[model samples]
Target: MTHLTLALDAMGGDVGPCVTVPAALQALASNPGLHLLLVGDPAALHPLLAKVDSALLSRLEIVPAESVIASDARPSQAIRASRGTSMRIALELIKTGRAQACVSAGNTGALIGLAKLLLKPLEGIDRPALVTVLPHQQQGKTVVLDLGANVECDSAQLVQFAVMGSVMAEEVLSLRNPRVALLNIGEEETKGLAAIRDAAAQLKNTPSINYIGYLEGNELLTGKTDVMVCDGFVGNVTLKTMEGVVRMFLSLLKSSSTDVGRKAKQAWWLTLIGRFIQRRLAKRFGHLNPDQYNGACLLGLRGTVIKSHGAANQRAFAVAIEQAMQAVQRQLPDRIAARLKTVLPKSD
Candidate 1:
């Protein structure tokens, strides 16, 4: 029998338990063996549970506590001081083996800090990077690592991220021998920073992984690379920039108003134009569901810690729950540890 439990932060995001609860209910309907330990004020979540049917409600276990950690609180202090905070409690469940993984769309900084403290990285992992799947044109999904967790990283760290990400794509997405690429300014041999150049050399020499050389930002959506790697600062900036651009284009598309003159038969044409634009925008940027990405998986940690966007919606929360379930099913952490054990350590 599959025995997996997830600890969810019911009071983490902007929507709080409202979104989190519904997502939990959604996940439970499909996964019977999956148990949920919702951490928040019992009273608050109980009302949400009232809306769920008895069958789904029985699968959930509400672990109520008093404190709530605001996004403004210092992450380190917040995790250290707030013992009863929902995020900390969820982490505790994973640490204590009560839950297989933890998912929270809470304060990302605090989530990262708390997770690092609670679940130490694999024996030699210098950093625990966040990995998110970016939508691709033909290949379905692509894995990008170090998405804002470690701002400063060495060449060795980048290489490690590539190895871990390769394993993830193969395991989770079932991509056989996923091709790896280092994110660089250009595809040329000597076009990146010192770190990229060094990582490129390291990757060339690295065995077991299908390293496909360097890739620029434009290559990400083309499905040319299955696993893209970079330092946290660069990856984070790129992710945000792409998201911003999508939003900007979507806004422009929405604002393109057709002139329906009072003395002309352009009203029908205007309506047609409006419908076409709406469909195109929805088809293009509609996939920008943060909920679909849900929470990012904190790779390199001993256990899984999923970080959700601060302003995540119900869709995002639901997606996060599914991601958490997939992580447990794939045995990602153990696979990563085993693979890393064979890789050479970075020289000081």
Candidate 2:
């Protein structure tokens, strides 16, 4: 029997339980074996469910949690100060073995801090990473790791991320011998800072991963590299910038017409060509839609903590729930743990 149970932080996002309640229903429709324990004020959730269809309401279980963490609260302070906050309670469900994974579209820092403190990292792993998927030119998507987890890392950590990310691509996406690359300024060996150089050397030496040497930032969308590894700082900036650029391009394409009367004439032409092209590109290479990859598996944690965008819409929220179900069914955390042991720097 598949013991798939999910703990959701119902009060974390902007829309709160209102959006989350409906999303839970959508997830249930898509995945029958899935079970959910919603952690938040029961009073708030009852009304939300009342608004939802009866079919979905039957699949949910509301676990009342009084305390709530404000978006601006510091992760450490909030987790410690409010024991009953939805985020903390959701973590407890995983720790207590009531749920296989926890999902929160709330504060990023709070989620990271709570995960590290509650679950701890696997042996020999120094830091956990947040990874996401991006469209590849080869008709699919590639996984990018450490998008915003450990900003500073040693050579060993970088090599480990390569191994972890590669396994994810292979196991999750079914890619064979997924090509791994160290994100660098240039493809050349001697192009980046000392940190990048040393990290590249370590990845090349690592036996478990198929390290394909340095990859420039532009190569990420080319589908040439299956997994791109970088420090959290660089990865976060790159992910956001790529998302921003895609959005800006779409905006310009939509409003290409300038004049009032002439605008109507040009709008039709732009709609027929430019608009069509922009929509396709955005679907393939853009990041404005959080629903594209709803939840980020907090890799390296003892248990899974799937993080979602705090402002996630219903679609994005549903994606997060679906991702949680997938991770549990696939044993992603256990797979990552076993894989990491192979490449962990052996103690003398």
Candidate lDDT scores, in order, read: 0.84, 0.81
lDDT of 1 by residue, 1-348 (tens): 386799999999877888888888888887888889999999898888776788878778998778778877887778778688899899999999999999998887788888888898886688799999988878388999999989989998898899899999999989998999999989899798998899889888878889999999998778998999999999999988877787686667666533223224657766786677667766776676444575789999899888877777777777888888888899999999888878756423
TM-score of 1: 0.90
Model 1 scores worst on lDDT over the 10 consecutive residues at 255-264
The 10 consecutive residues of candidate 2 with the worst lDDT sum are: 254-263
Q: Please provide TM-scores, in order, for all candidate models, with all chains considered together.
A: 0.90, 0.89
Residue runs of model 2 more than 4 Å from their true location after superposition: 1-3, 255-290
Error in Å for residue 232 of model 1: 1.0
* Total residue pair clashes for candidate 1: 1
**Which candidate has the highest lDDT of all?**
1
Count of steric clashes across candidates, in order: 1, 0
